[model samples]
Target chain A: MNPTPDGFSTRHRGGKKSAARKVRRSSAVNRPSTVKRGKVVSVADGNAAIISKSFQLRSMQRAWNRFHAGSLSHWTTTIIIALSLTIFGAFTLLLSNANTALDNWTGDNLVTVFLEERTSIEQIESIQTEISKKSGVDQISVVSPAQAMARMKNMLGSEAGLLDSLDDNPLPFSIEFRLTDKKYKKTANLVYEIGTWQGVEAVSYDQIWAEKLAAVIHTFRFVGIALTVLLLTAVALIISNTIKLTIIARRDEVEVMRFMGATDSFIKTPFVYEGVLQGLFGAIGALLLTSLLYWGGQGAAAELGAAFGIFFELHYLQVGQLLIIMALGIFLGLIGALISLSRFLEI
Target chain B: MSSESLPLLIAKGLKKAFSVGKNSSLEVLKGIDLSIDKGEMVALLGDSGSGKSTLIQILGTLDRPSSGVVTLNGINLFALNPKEQAVVRNQKIGFIYQFHRLLPEFSARENVMMPLLIGRCSPKLAKERAGEILEKVGLAGRLDHRPGQLSGGEQQRVAIARSIVTEPVLLLADEPTGNLDSRTAGSVFELLQKLNQDLGLSCLMVTHNNELAQNLDRQLHMIDGCLAEEERGK
Candidate 1:
């Protein structure tokens, strides 16, 4: 006999005649019994194959059915998750805009040393050279009294006639230099050292307000992160409780499936899918809410910036940040489902 | 070795105990030794709490014995891991509960298709087999009826169809007709008998109906966690 691909052994030609003769003699009584055993064994082997795609589809169907059956509760949990994420997203938007405004304010890092009224050009040049030689100085420029007066007139915009009525230029000659290191302490120390110079009348920089704003931003960031953590934890807990309720409602069905020999994965997969679906929908809702908030707040924020004479524009979350939020929602849902299943689902 | 000589299922010295208190335990099955041959329909009769259900559970691999061995087709059932045992239950054993236990949300056809689906059979084949078996149990016209819509007898017929749809080697029925009227119970028992004769499906049924028990191949009576008497039925 030769082994065939379908796992049956084929008899050679010599036995074929006798096999056919025997089959013809008692075909009704004998043929089907042997064929029936073979078919059953084949079916059993088929059963032992990997889990079918149909099973997964059925689980998804069941999950969707349960989700529909508890629409009110599921939607309520989803809204809670959306609201939590919206709050977090709002804080993120605020911090992002604040940080951008602060960056623009401190970007120049310029220090101005005002000269005495009678300082000579030679003295101004000497001060400029000395400032340029400092450790953190990048670019130095000498601003004559006339140039300073011109800058003031330009700033006054449509009021330059009032500047001309001063009868004489009272602006002081100054030397400005850009600092490579913008640290408040470094800039302050440099200003103090320059104030003691021979011909320098005063020294000033915008480091104080920048440093204060930076501190405020840091504090706000910390608080926002802490708040987001708390809110997400609460959301996860709510999801866990919601899933627990559904499990309780279906407790009898679960027990029946277990007795019918459903695998643990088979029983639990639908619940896991339910959690994931909740998270996915919740995240989508949060994104939509956050977008609405951004559009609603954009014009108001711009007007507020104009009041303070600062150019402020609200930027929506970056692609990476949006992805992070979505991922967090999904992860929280998974964790919540796992928590409930581990605690309540004994099978 | 012929199929008739080798029993399809055998339980030797099976014992089960439950811890009742800190220092006390309740024994359910002191020790049970039983076997059911191929194509044999055996009836188990006992009063309430006589360990009949526990024995059925153990033999079906739904529960484990505290000690002793249960071999189905010469394979030690308890020796397999839970996952493998579940596979055995899915493919080799079928259960018919007293309450018909059909998922109320699904129709009769879907309920009957469940075991085959659990065994990873294709949905189309499961549906065809389920429909065929439902018709075989005289429920052809009620395939779409949910359990809530079906009468008690019709529900039991659906349950029978589900149990036999898998074509399992052994059917462990715990009071399959317990909740039906005598007329309904007799009809259900006749269906079981017909399936046994036509399909050669082996069964171990727990029942309180002695009249029905007397028609099976054998009847074992349980009394206080022990098999007290055995009678060959005609």
Candidate 2:
């Protein structure tokens, strides 16, 4: 559409390699007595024209034109591919940041006490007052069932919509007490001491959470690595398969180019550009979607914190990290093109 | 070092064999020596299985000979690497197959500009050159027509234009007009002769048309991988 590109023109002959430009003058055709042709361009020069750098730029322009000239079906497949990659990238982003969120949750080193199911506000107040008297004690806060539900909703973000079907608040009122690090031994003794209180039905401590969080983080690191490999493989295959179809469609053109002495670079450059562009654009799309989701999450977290005193944040990925994601997109595209092209073109 | 006195292409002791099985081989081209001088158009007459294509493939550097050396413009063609040979093919040699092999996706001008683009000419320069050659082939009015839209004669003419657009030193054509009707073939062949004369283009043609062979400067027959001069001469 943009002036038949070099892709269609990468197979012609050289009349005078330009090296032969000044080397000839004696041919009978040069004398113009017998030759009847009009405006003849003699290539009597021994060498063909040298390949120019501008042709490469023109070649890329051609490739870009072809890349965008696909039908609706082609674009749909590409966008669907971008969406799948976005889902995977978003999941990975969340997984990578999980440790940070866990650290924030465990940072205070607090203990929670679940009161009896029907405990009244007076009974919870008495227990909270009694716990405040213990050594190594930080301030204790009483959490009602409605406040607890609100905290859970904040943590769940968009998934909080699932809570509307519930019959009623399934949680009970609880007391959360923060312990100071300087009296770490006293903190454990206080937690045991509180377990024996009259109104307390069950007690929870951050020590267990601290231990569990560390273990889960370590295990998840391995899982995240495995998922990364699988995600990359999927990206490569999707791009490879799509590009392969294009290559198959143009096999004859490719063969003609090869026979006409077109180099591997000459024939393969456009397809490779297609793959890279697809990957890069796809990656950009995924990153944008991921960012939008994280923004929504950050807002939800802020709302929950203001309403129930819980802390969380979905901090945006740093610039260096974002660049790495972009690099990953570019790399996926190149590898995909290489895989498909190598199989189909045998180059 | 002077190309003026050196032949356009020379092949000496060229032998090619294929492995038909585990230990044995089938010799397609027997040891042979051949040469084409500057601006000479020589026709090689042979039947289908007479090894003419195999010989030309080697001479064109598309395929290497089992044991032989080919020198084009006094530089040993086979001695160069595949990449170098490809450059030579694009710059110095042009080929026309029986089928015209033009890329159907492109217009006549675009198809004609392929070799120049492959050789890395600027797009503007390539376009001008392609227009000139297409005009020479009498396709000035059909530069934008795709191959499918053109008649067989016009398509073959486009193919010839592409082959000669680079002004190659040697043109190796295999049954160039084989796919066309007699009338179309005659006109295309005549166009080829006119090009050979007007541009001082050297040519090596393999054809089964004996009647057409009498018009070239010289004729030779390839019989079972051997070459013998035919009494037919212009």
Q: Alpha carbon lDDT of residue B87, candidate 2?
A: 64
Instruction: Tell me the tens digit of each residue's lDDT in model 1 across A137-169.
Output: 987888888999889888789988887668788
What is candidate 2's DockQ? Answer: 0.33
CAPRI grade of model 2: acceptable
lDDT of 2 by residue, A53-73 (tens): 434665577667767785553
| Per-model tally of clashing residue pairs | 0, 15
What digit string (tens of lDDT, one per residue) describes model 2 on residues B43-74? Answer: 99988898999988888887889998888877
Q: Compose the digit string of candidate 1's lDDT tens values, residues B1-234.
A: 754578989999999999999999999999999999989999999999999999998998878899999988777888777666766677678889899999897889888877665654444555667788899999999998899999999999999988877667899999999999999999999999999999788999999999999999999999999998999999
For model 2 chain B, the run of ten residues with the poorest summed lDDT: B116-125
